[model samples]
Target: MLKKDIHPEYGPCQVACACGNRFETRSTLKEIKVAVCSSCHPFYTGKRGAVVIEAGRVEKFQRKYAGTRFGKPAQETEEKEQG
Candidate 1:
């Protein structure tokens, strides 16, 4: 026999995502919030533009190493040649 009042309550719950997608489901909590969902997820929706970038990280990295040579930096290259 199953114990009564031992398990947490399960009822209808609302899920909201960062992309403004909302759905209803059953859960212990009354409301749920998530950063990603099927509607906005890149893998699920198969959209390349869905990717989110912050603070121009790719641009910053390119700028920082724009003058550097390939593979190793100048200091490492010099050290390798000496040893």
Candidate 2:
């Protein structure tokens, strides 16, 4: 059984960040830091953009229609007038 104490302790103390970002706060222990804060982080600073790409997608499509007639010019349609 654990008894109630006036103070508590936490792990992972002094978390120094790689982006030179640091701050102080309270958790289950003392002293804590983090890497990549809102000042330079991609997500926090909105610097990163969406990524969209598929493997062999462009190649697959080109191989599927190597020399098809799909690129042909549009066909001319006759127009009729009704009174």
Candidate 3:
């Protein structure tokens, strides 16, 4: 049994946010336009960029300890010492 007179009467059937987010929830009216759109979001825009390169870090380390006893094996150093 559907009663027309007993039904709720809500005005402005549609609601829209300034962020371009639109939704409908049984409003008595209808909205058609929104302001801001998610198309320009940082995540959606794919514009985030980050790059890093350690300039001369490896080269500096190598140059500073080119032929030193830092990483030489124990047997090689022992042979050199014996020789």
lDDT scores in order: 0.80, 0.53, 0.58
TM-score-based ranking: 1, 2, 3
How do the residues 29-50 of candidate 1 rate in per-residue lDDT, one tens digit apiece?
Answer: 9999887889987889888667
Q: Rank the candidates by lDDT, best first.
A: 1, 3, 2
Tell me, by lDDT, which candidate is best. 1
Clashes of each: 0, 3, 4
Which residue pairs does candidate 3 place in steric collision? 12-29, 13-27, 13-28, 13-29
Off by over 4 Å in 2: 1-3, 6-15, 49-83
lDDT for model 2 comes to: 0.53
Clashing pairs in 1: none
**What tens-digit string does per-residue lDDT give for candidate 2 at 1-83?**
66668556644455446566566554675665554555665666776642213335677887887556443333411121221
TM-score of each: 0.61, 0.35, 0.30
Q: Rate residue 62 of model 1 by lDDT.
A: 76
Of 2 and 3, the candidate ranking higher by TM-score: 2
Pairs of residues at least 3 apart in sequence or in different chains that clash in candidate 2: 9-28, 10-28, 10-29
Candidate 3 all-Cα RMSD: 16.6
TM-score of 3: 0.30
| CA deviation > 4 Å runs, candidate 1 | 51-83
